[model samples]
Target: MSKLVGSLQGYIWRGYLMAGKNTNKLLSGQATISSKSYAYSAKEIYYSTLPYAATYHKSAVTGYDPTKTKPETSYGAISRSVISNYQPSMTKAQIQTVIAFEQAKKSVPDFRIVDVPYQASDGTEMVPVVQVFSAPYRDLDDYDHDGKWTTEATVRNVLLAQENGSGKIFESNPEAQQVELVGPQYAFPDDDAAMLSSNYYGIDNTTRIIKRVGQFVMLSSRLKSGIFYAKASDLITLNTNKPTVIDGIPYVTSMPLAPASPNHYVDTASGKALKAAGYTKVRTLFDDSMNEYRLKNGVWTDSLFASFETKIFSPDFDYRHVYFNVSDTDEGKIKSNKVITLNEGNNDFKKLLMAPTETLLGK
Candidate 1:
């Protein structure tokens, strides 16, 4: 019988397709639910603001009289006015662009701009004007042709030069020779020893020595107290009173334990080592039986011998052919052994089966 020949199998196949549809619906529904929640929250905020606005206006107009029954504007009318005036004027795309711009501004601190309201050329209505500051510069003389600096370094240098009387003055026209240095007015002592002898003049010898000693100590500690080399065999404790035994293996005092090298039996050269250790591909039943031992369950147990069907024949025979002139039968048998029995109503199994096929088919 064919593996796909069953009503239950057909149902399972169709169930996989249905599961994909359900998954798409679920994902789309999640977006809808989020949008609905946001709308509900906005509605709640809009309604909540009405009472506060009503109270504030009533208190301001009527001086918060306790005996007053009603305000000049009804609460319902205030709510309606708020709802009409406070309706979102910006489109979704515009809102998203604003959000993105705000996020970008936060991430990149150099980007700064402000919206200034200005009257139009017609002088009828006010329009928003985007005023952008000069981009930050990293060095002096890094300004554009318009003389707008684009880096922080340029701005800092200009400020420092201005304070030090070395900056150029640009009033109507540029002025030259703006900075000038004069000769020092104070005199210096001729004797270096007399200058050193003055206690308040400079650091004393004792303080210098203390500073040097502290620096040396810090450097030595950071360098792990100077490097020292030793052989691996010499890394052993010489304590005879307390013996070190790990995992039932006793280590001799003052004697180094060399780590065993990993066995690389996969390499051709290393396979010879396995051969030297008496490991072979073929072994008789008696040779195998010799390795079996009686377990705690009072039963002798040996290594399991697993047989698989294969077309190839070799000296290393892990597989055995049981059927003669029946390759199709062998294939069928192998496929039957590997059959995955999924439940009819299992959505997970359906998704697993359909997702990959759909992805491959570009569905």
Candidate 2:
């Protein structure tokens, strides 16, 4: 039997395509069925924004001969494996409801609408998601010139008709969905070398680097007390070698830490340290918003912890801004954004799928 294509992040998975087969093993937490009208499973799959355009030769950067690599015809199409997890037993009405819910909540930065069509092995219908933009690239020279790739094939943050206007939309839709595409990012799973790649950062910037395990340092976000501390660990490699201590607490520097970049945070190495230390998740509180990241199978995952209507204060200007140690039941006053409700469909959403490639690429 031929293997089915499943989107994890945005990369295709081969044999591990079945949605329910050993699902318990794949998820860090137990799976449960929701009782809402738009009922869905609580099973979480580690996903990232599709890191590349719909059709780029996989062998381009690896220097592999194209002739030797069997081309993937379904390279950019959203696969059934992803939609099934959203609602393994979803009826057509339920599927449509899910789509409506996503479209209504599109204001969330990472929220995307699954607009393509799919079918299950059992002949069930499934809807697909369109990725808002391709993965972030390093430079125009490397992504466009040296690689012989178009800006449409590399750049991110494409404008959509729904978000922008009809004047900015890509004509030929990639026929794909929003899920993590597992690729080179997982190759060097055990080292900071993976962090060196520009594909990791969503924006173009000089990638600061550090070497050796001892160079790792942890910094706290600036607190109300105007103090920040750093701690060193061999479990991960940080971009800085400098560690400063204030009030018996070591910090990366006397600076305010923002949770914009995970590299400035920690990689899988540090993720393991966090897990082993009995921390369920790391919450990065920035101004009015808080985001949660988890390490499953030694890979860091992106998840929103909360969106505070008012600024979040850590009670004291201390480590609470960055490193969080708490149980799931201690959510205090933070509101959960996972609730989904059905709404009328938006036709502009379909145009938003692939209408901004040229605009984003500056064509």
Q: Which candidate wins on TM-score?
A: 2
Q: TM-scores for all candidates?
A: 0.13, 0.17
- Candidate 2, residue 145: the lDDT equals 21
Give per-residue CA lDDT, model 1, range 215-326, as digits (tens): 1210001111111111111122212322233223222222111113432112132223323443332111110011111111221122112111222344542111111111
What tens digits encode model 2's per-residue C-alpha lDDT throughout 1-363?
A: 111223322222322222433332332222231211111122111221222222334433321121222222111122234323333232333333433443455362322222222222223233333223222345756754223211111001111112222221111222321111111121111221111111211101111122222333211111110111111221112122232222232222112222346344334444455555555445332222234444444545553333211012434321101121121221122322232111211111112111222321224
Instruction: Kindly report which residue pairs in candidate 1 clash with one another.
Output: 135-150, 136-150, 136-151, 137-150, 137-151, 137-152, 138-151
Question: What are the runs in model 1 whose C-alpha is more than 4 Å off?
Answer: 1-96, 101-114, 129-363
Deviation of model 1 at 291, angstroms: 99
Model 2 CA deviation exceeding 4 Å by range: 1-94, 105-127, 131-250, 254-363
Task: Report the poorest 10 consecutive residues by lDDT, candidate 1.
Answer: 191-200
